[model samples]
Target: MRIKNSTVVITGADSGIGRATALRFAKKGARVVLASRDAAALETLAADCRRRGAKALAVQTDVADPEAVEELCESAVGNFGRIDIWVNNAGTGVFGPFLDTPLEDIQRVVDVDLMGVVHGAREALEQMRAQGEGVLINVASMAGIIPQPYTSAYSMSKAAVRALGVSLRSELRLARVKDIHVVTVSPGAVDTPFFDHVANYTGQDTRPIPPTYSPDKIAAAIVNVARSPQRELTVGLIPKAMVAKHKLFPQAVERRMATLTHRKHLKATQPAPPTKGNLDRAAGDDATGRRGRKTGGHGGRTKTMARRLLVIGGAAGVTAFAAFRWRQ
Candidate 1:
């Protein structure tokens, strides 16, 4: 679908990838509908979108609430007539050992990250049915495809998000809704306030793992996907490599992730008390920023650690043996 004159609804438009995507679509001449729990932030983004030469609406919403998502769709169609594209970018995270993390926090993660996507997809599909066509872009994570060592709740939620999109697409295909597209975007650690907002229980200041990309990278993918929908879109070279590595050398990649998530994520920052973040309610002013603080200047050390982990974890030999067998 052409971005110009298309109506696009983006959840979590207050910050991070959602914010970037909202601006991107707006600049492309699409009418933008912004949804998030932060009313003030959404309003600000709405103003920005208007400045970008697109009609904009800011709908304060918690995507975890099916009612709120329903209202969002109603508002969009009520205002714009129909939604041409819906980007399910609303997400939250809880970063800690699965066993140590509170059940509530885990539930919150699922509510926002996985079920949030489900709610948006369902609502979008309903609206698309009315129009007979639409696009659903879900922002998943590379961690969804591979295990992150410490953030089990977040990792699991993302994995479920991917599954949700894939399953929905298959159902849509069977139903012959060929023009209604469901697209999943998987990006590695991105330089966005997403890290600053996750519920933290590791007793340390959170840091995004290495090989981070800017939010614009993911936003561009979203816009591009809207132009021509694909089943799965992975952003960043490292993210693509990580997914491939996980597919062909799961043990090796798991070991590497374990080692780095310890040194690079958990132990790299100062200690802090556990918090539920924005999962339970609206995020604080601290979550207002769009970009992450970490520049991740330690790529060399991470690469070295990855090599050492592969050798020590015995996966290097496994890869070589598999290659040899394939050649034979």
Candidate 2:
């Protein structure tokens, strides 16, 4: 579908991937509606989009609240006349041993990460079904596929999101809703404020896993998917290969991922106190001491790590395919 003049709504638009995606859509001449718990930030983003010559509206929303999400949809239609694309990008996470993590924090993660997607998708689908044509993009994560040991809640919520996309597609197919589409995007570790805003109980500082791609990269993927919808998309090359490997060797890959997450995802040397980071409310600039920093939690080895992962993934993909063919 053409993006120019398309009406698009993006949640979690205050910063990170959502923020980037909103800007990309704006640049493409799409009418954009920005949603987030941070009203001021959303207004700023809306102004930025308008400056770029796109119609934009800032709606302060907590995606966990179904009513608020419903209002968000109404606002979009009232302003733009129709909904063409809805990106369910609002999410939060918790990182700690399941037993050590606070129960409330676990619930909050589900509320924001899982239920938030649920609310956005539900509201958007209803609007799309009425219009008979639209796209719904749900942002899941690699953790949903390869299991992270410490972040049980976060992983579970993301896994559920992946399942939700599958179920929605099946339902749409059965109903012969050909024009309406549901797309799931599973992104690899990304350079976003997510690590900084995560609820951490590990008694250590958190960081994104290696080979972290910039939020802009993921934003581009989301925008591309909106133009040409697909049932599912693994955004990064490394994540795509790891997903394939997991399909062939779930147990081995799961074990290796668990080990890597322990060694690299969390920084034991950098001790930090536990806090409920952005799970319940919007953790604005003051949440992390670096007030204006939007991304860059990962180290500076992104390009190098990506190259290494690509080589390893290519070799693994060839070997795996060859082995399967030999058995057949």
- Leading candidate by lDDT: 2
Give the alpha carbon lDDT tens digit for every residue of 233-301 in model 1.
988655665665577779988899888888887754578888887677776574556676554553223
Locate the minimum summed-lDDT window of 10 residues in model 2: 286-295
What's the CA error at residue 167 for candidate 2, in Å? Answer: 0.7
TM-score of each: 0.90, 0.93
TM-score for predicted model 1 compared with the true structure: 0.90
Colliding pairs, model 1: none
lDDT by residue for model 2 over 204-288, one digit each (tens)?
8887767778778889999999999999999876788788777777898899999898988788888989888878788776322
Total backbone collisions for each predicted model: 0, 0
Global lDDT of each candidate: 0.83, 0.86
